[model samples]
Target: MSESEQLMVVDEAGQPLYTATRQDVHTQGLWHETFHCFVIDSIKQQVVLQQRADQKKDFPGMLDITAAGHLLAGESVADGVRELEEEIGLVKSFEELHGLGVYQEELRLPGFIDRERIHLFLTDSAKPLTGYSLQTTEVRRLLAFSFAEFARLAEEETTVLTTVEGETIQRNQFVPHPTDYWKTVYAGIKAYCER
Candidate 1:
């Protein structure tokens, strides 16, 4: 089934309520569960970011999470590991992921209201950017950025730039995740890297 047609376990303002189609959930501004993974290369102290496919209905052509997707109805958070492979072609087990806890996030677009109880995770990888096999329909390409530099960008109010894939990448180039969201991400990956 297409992602938009898939069944999602709905939440009413963070409380589990019922099941609805992905389309219904977003159009109605209902809450839903989502999985977000940040792939880090500890040896290189960098993290991978995927450029969403231009054809995507939401956030198309924008640099976003390393891998992320909504959880289907009846699926546990652990089941989200499939997204890692499906979106970026990195096969990994659930036990290999470091839990970063769940976060409440909401996005208000012109026609889309996305409220997600995001189950965040972090995983270490040493593979080069070329090692990833992009799911062309979902992700356009992957770029690696310095972990420390990314954290700085997330924590600071001023503009920060980092070289990614031979091009300069700044805060505006990414999806506008709230500052608190990025701080949680930075702290999670930083703690994981130090472990």
Candidate 2:
């Protein structure tokens, strides 16, 4: 982890209070801003997901959003578009993303406390899975699954299978987030795809 990276610490109301090192932000339980980008291939009715690198400090080896990263202390939400290029090598303009609005999430564990205002965005990428230039240190592989299958899994149905780097994976391999969060994101992306 980069302890020297500066992050904007926010209050409970999501107002920026001050700047702190990334280490302090997590160690002190301070709220911060993060960007989440979900890629949907509307024509194929599939959503792209990424396997976090096994060496990642957080959620290592778990399936996660297509791309995500924290915004630096002086960065604007629009500036976060860089994360997609940096993490997954998908270079996209801010205008290409469909804004899904900001949401707050708080998770507390033994040694981690994350309180984040997530700025979500969606993009329709028709590129082949093999086209992505993976940042090996942050991402392991990319996978795609039918949006409908994901919806069923979100509803607690067992045995959702997805193809990851040519192999099949089960639902247990995914990051276990609240069902409501999954449903909300699914609904949002579905609506966007339909439009």
Candidate 3:
């Protein structure tokens, strides 16, 4: 098991309050900062997604963002760029990322209380599927979906056939983020591509 990490706790308004261990933050429902990155291959109209490792404590075995992780105590949002390299072996400078804005979300479950302010970003990558080096402990594999198909499934809230690691899968296999969240992410990437 991985040791608990220290995180910078914040208030509803996103002001830093204090520091606490990752376990305590989730257990107490404290708000914390997190970074989320979405990789889009606009030219190919595809988005990269990662399947969370089954051993993960939260949302294990779920398909999630291209890269995401918490901000350690005393670290700024820019420091979060490390997640790209750590989780998916994508080394990118902060300047290379396009900020998509922060989103606040709270999820309460039986043994988890996750309140997070997510600093979202969008990046363009033409790298092939085989180029990513998966952190076996955090991510299991990588997959891609066309923007059109993603929007269609998100709008219908229904599953669609897709490919994952050369295997056919359903779109609902993704993390169950709120529909609006998916819309916002889609719009962000669409706008970026348009620019």
Compare the candidates by TM-score and give the number of the best one. 3
Clashes of each: 0, 0, 0
* Candidate 3 local lDDT, 1-195, one digit each (tens): 233878989998889989999999988999999999998888888989899999987788888899998999999999999999998899899999999999888888887888999999988899987899989999998888888766654575566646523466666677767767778888898889888
lDDT of 1 by residue, 36-55 (tens): 99999888888888999999
Screening candidate 3 with a backbone cut-off below 3 angstroms (N, C-alpha, C), the clashing residue pairs are none
Which consecutive 10 residues in model 1 have the weakest lDDT in total?
Answer: 1-10
Instruction: Kindly report which residue stretches of model 3 are placed more than 4 angstroms away from their true locations once superposed.
Output: 1-3, 164-168
User: Tens digit of lDDT per residue, candidate 2, span 1-195?
Assistant: 487899999876778999999988887788999999998898888889999999998889999899999999889999989889988999999999999888788777778788888898989999988999999999999888888766765677766575533466777788776676677789888889777
lDDT of 2 at 164: 31
- Per-prediction TM-score: 0.92, 0.91, 0.92
Stretches of candidate 1 exceeding 4 Å from the true structure: 1-4, 10-15
TM-score-best of 1 and 3: 3
Q: Residue 16 of candidate 1: its Cα lDDT?
A: 63
> What's the residue-level lDDT of 9 in candidate 3?
94
